[model samples]
Target: GSRQGKDERTTSPSSNFLLSHLQSIIGSPSFPYSSNSPNSLSPLLFLLHSFLRICSIPTGRPIRMGNACGRGKRPAASRDTSARDNEPRVAVNENESDRERDEKPAVTPSPKASMKRSSTPPTGAMVTSRTRASTARRPSTNRSPNASRARDREKEREREKAKEREREKEEEEDDPIQKFITYALNKGVSGLRAEFEELRLKTIPTKEQCSVFHMVANAQKNRYKDVPCSDDSRVILKELSMGTDYIHGNFCGTPKNPKRFICTQGPLPTTIVDFWSMVWQEGSEFIVMLCNFNEMGKVKCAQYFPPTQKETFVAGNAVITCESVAKQKWPGEVTIRRFTLDRIDVNQKRTITHLHWESWPDRGVPPIDATIQKLLQMVCRSSKPAVVHCSAGIGRTGTTVSIQIVTELMDSGKSMETGLGPFLIKMRKQRAGSVQNDQQYVFIHRLLLERYMSEEEKENAKFVKFAKDYDSFMV
Candidate 1:
């Protein structure tokens, strides 16, 4: 009964003075005991809070030094200085296999002699102190300035590790499309054998499809940017940071200049991705095409230049987030699903906007217009414009946007020829460093014709084929 009572006393909010202090600092929104908090705060923690506010410092961020509220089942507050000094050396369970490990932060007890208050040790009487000391409050058992910071550093390390994992995954996502496009360029799009001719026939190693599954492997610690695209094969996996704000291309393509790189989250220009392409896809005999899309299904390149730029009214654009749900079975298998990102802002210069396609899915997976309509409806009450892109945003991204554009114009009673000519000219100027190949030119043109024309017509037409599912080749 005494042990149980002690346990209750140890775990309860009343005992941990630091928890009370943290509550005053972070505030009562999360706690039941939250009082008229500001009125209750001792002038000290309030001063610290004010200092943080003045610095424009993020208070809750792991990098910052802030009081950490202890959570979970609390151990009975230790008495006896020798016992405290000789804290058990519990073996870490690697995973949270033990209750104690799960409940407490890792702290190896120091081998140095016990720290006892020279005059009066933390006695049971002090623990049950009925009177508050008038002279001064002695240090508590839990007092440690570096512990919270150490925990913060550990948490920060975990955050960085998770971010690094995500980037490696995204690069992995960019891999297959990179390989397939490279296969088309080097081996020619005729067969699967050509996709991985290096491997034995019928032995389709998943490694050949690394581009398909970026999250293929659970990364080992300290491994950042694992299994990246070879330099020459030209894979440009453009990554973005979070947020939905209007970004204009006043000055494009400045890496070191810093001022040149301004947009957030959507794909960067083709110039940037293309510049890195040679480095990302280096070793292969032939050049590979790049696949650069966002967590959302829409391509970033398409978002940049648009007849397809999405329109919004009550909503600004789609805010995006993603998680890798599919679990891979073998050593190297990835399970990731991408989603479209929210648009930054509306172009006041244009009366209307809709998603356009510079290139369409080679598999004819789904109509770009239909997909755009569905995504736009999700973003705003009505459909807004959008564009699709792969790394060399000019090619695939431009083409997908162009295809969607053609259909939109046709809906407006504009002829295919009229839309096609003008759109291509603009694409050339928009992405001009490299040669926009004839095959890519034809690919977009075919997709434009593919959109208005029936599926039966596509079936009847010979020489090319489309896939049955989203598992089609274009992915």
Candidate 2:
């Protein structure tokens, strides 16, 4: 008995020292084993069981190590609170049969056994691993390659459409012709008429201010007595020995080219000789007549040139002969006549091309056609200054001249701010009255719109069609 006591005392302290070391290692934060792992405490538990069996403890009794197993002590009444309390725990089982079973090499526990053994809540590593498994099984929210490419293509198409719209807007702004057409369409005919009236009411030179000297000195030369030429721009006949040096024509054009055209009244019976004399002296090679000799039973213009081919007429010292006649090359009542003018005194001869538009009435607009454009081309092609005429010289004459000037300005790509109003006001400085009425003014806008607008735009512009139907847009 004394020897047994000695062995007990010796083993007691050794067991206490081992238990203290094991408790410290398990409680450390850097412990490699998880409390929830099946094999985590197996080796330690086996060493403790062997030591306890050698100490003479009862084989059937369980050794409870209070908080040493990483769990706090609980009440005896609450010991059976969890379902795991009824099951045999690997940590506390000390029966001889269980000890013999544990003595063999540690076998990996089945999943069911591991689950039952881990009665406590899972550790951080275990929860992290379970979360990873769940994440791998979930459906992905990311798009596939084809779907991503389709979305990118849609965005690219939208960008291209935006760029196209910007390009069209730039074209509309840069092109003056398109700008004017858009303005006219938006304003419509009535608005254009009101705008023209407003422009006419602005500051312009009066008849008394414009024709001071010509009103008295050149009264009989003017076809209409009210229509007097400005002294500054009057066409003076060189042959002063035969008669007066005055003719009722004004030099009219843009500021760049002032002598581009000589706007005049149609020749009267008495002024026909002076007309031919003025034409011969000015070196004019083209004549644009905007009226017929007889209209509505009134003599609008004199039969100035000969009617038949090769017909000759003696007008003062100039021998005028008709060279050729091409009837109606234009769409309407238009005629082209070629004439040869021979100056007997100076012995100089020059050819003349006359384009007579007979359909345009007095104080009215002409038909919308290629007539004006064709005439503009012919006048521009001539090397010498051209003469343009209608009855009274300011109505159709001013409109035609204004159209030519604006066309040249447009073709040269010059920027204009307020459209043709400023140019017309400038022309009126040289001639007393130009663009005679509001109807004639709006007609110019319509003619330009007809010239430049596309067929699709014309179809879409309902106001343009409305104006055409209500107003006399055509001849």
Candidate 3:
């Protein structure tokens, strides 16, 4: 056929010329065509091979003299042969071919070659298995077995330490007494004093006129003109028809026990009957008197109870008889008196314990001695509510009551970081002026700090220094 003859003429001359030219270029020493080198002429050889394959295609049309590599379609017979013979036919050394395959850039695949590749199964699974086997054979990065064990032991120790710290935190949270002790010790004496002053000044409300105490009918009932009685917690007399049921007293205690003590002023001569009435009405078995009947020639309180044993005094429907009197001066100056209280109208009788702390001055704190502690113990032993009183019922009386409250809270494991201040505020809410002065406030902290110290610590010279520092700060 004419087309076949024309194809032979087109392919014979151009293909032989390109092949000879490629061989000449490769033989040149300056061309850098090495078997191991990354730079190679494999791509140019493949292009020339494709051009020869296209020229050899025997189409019926005359072989065009235009560009053979551009837009020209290969006949069906040539397509299969060209796809199989995509690589150059010029033979090279086997080792050089392997090197070229590894280093040479990938050549773009013809359409038929791409279709053949897509139909074959992939080899990724085999490669992944080989990679896993190689990784398993690799050695660990640790220097030695001993060093590895040492690192593990250090990590275990760190974990145990963290666990121990967590346990201690839980214990501190569970035991409020220890927590409070830690807090106090952390804040030393001066720090505690400053905190007390700050709490008193910032949080505690000042004394203001209470409308109920200011009423004309109840105004004369108060012993001190300045101290006001809270109407909400005041004890009301049952026999109100006799006169007024007003009494200068309040039901004051901690949050846990609100009516632990009946805080009242020292009995006036006129209000002695009212005071006795309050005692009977409240069913109080103990009375704590922190003031004397006379101090510095001033009448701080009236002789409400009988002065001598076997002596009796009648006030309203109650008869109060002094049964016995005992005085002690070892721990501190205190007088203990027993009284038998009889209600004539009801035909009932009860014994009352009277603890008179005479050494404590009016509007002042008592000595930090065992006397106050002993007095508190006596009050605690009695199963009934105790009546505590000073001249105005706001200084020494409030201090004693607050001390008992704080001590009870610490023993019972109740929270006490901010409880003391709020508890004092609650007391003042009941009694207008519960804690009288800043000195009394500091005295409360002092007593608490003393209780926190051990007996050995107390005898130490460090404690003596602390006492001096406390006294100077108070001054």
| C-alpha root-mean-square deviation, each candidate | 41.2, 14.7, 18.0
TM-score of each: 0.23, 0.64, 0.60
- How much is the lDDT of residue 442 in candidate 3? 62
Candidate 1 lDDT, 312-374, residue by residue in tens: 222223232221123332222222223223334532221222223223343232333344333
Q: Residues 1-475, candidate 2, lDDT per residue (tens digit)?
A: 2111111111244565565576567656577753544547745664674575467322222333433443333212213224432333333233335346546543446444554465332343244455556556655557767788999999999999999999999977998777666666777777767777877777355666655435465666667755556766777777662357777788886535768899988898878888887787778899999987888898889888887799998887888899999977556656888999998988989999988887887887877788888777877786567999988889999998988888778777766546676776777767767889877888888787778778778787565574574365443
Q: What are the clashing pairs of model 2?
A: none
Instruction: Choose 1 or 3, whichever is better by TM-score.
Output: 3
- TM-score of structure candidate 3: 0.60
Give the TM-score (vs. native) of candidate 1. 0.23
Q: How well is each residue in 168-234 modelled by candidate 3, as lDDT tens digits?
A: 9997787766555555555556676676576656544333436656777876677777677876777
**Each model's backbone clash number:** 50, 0, 0
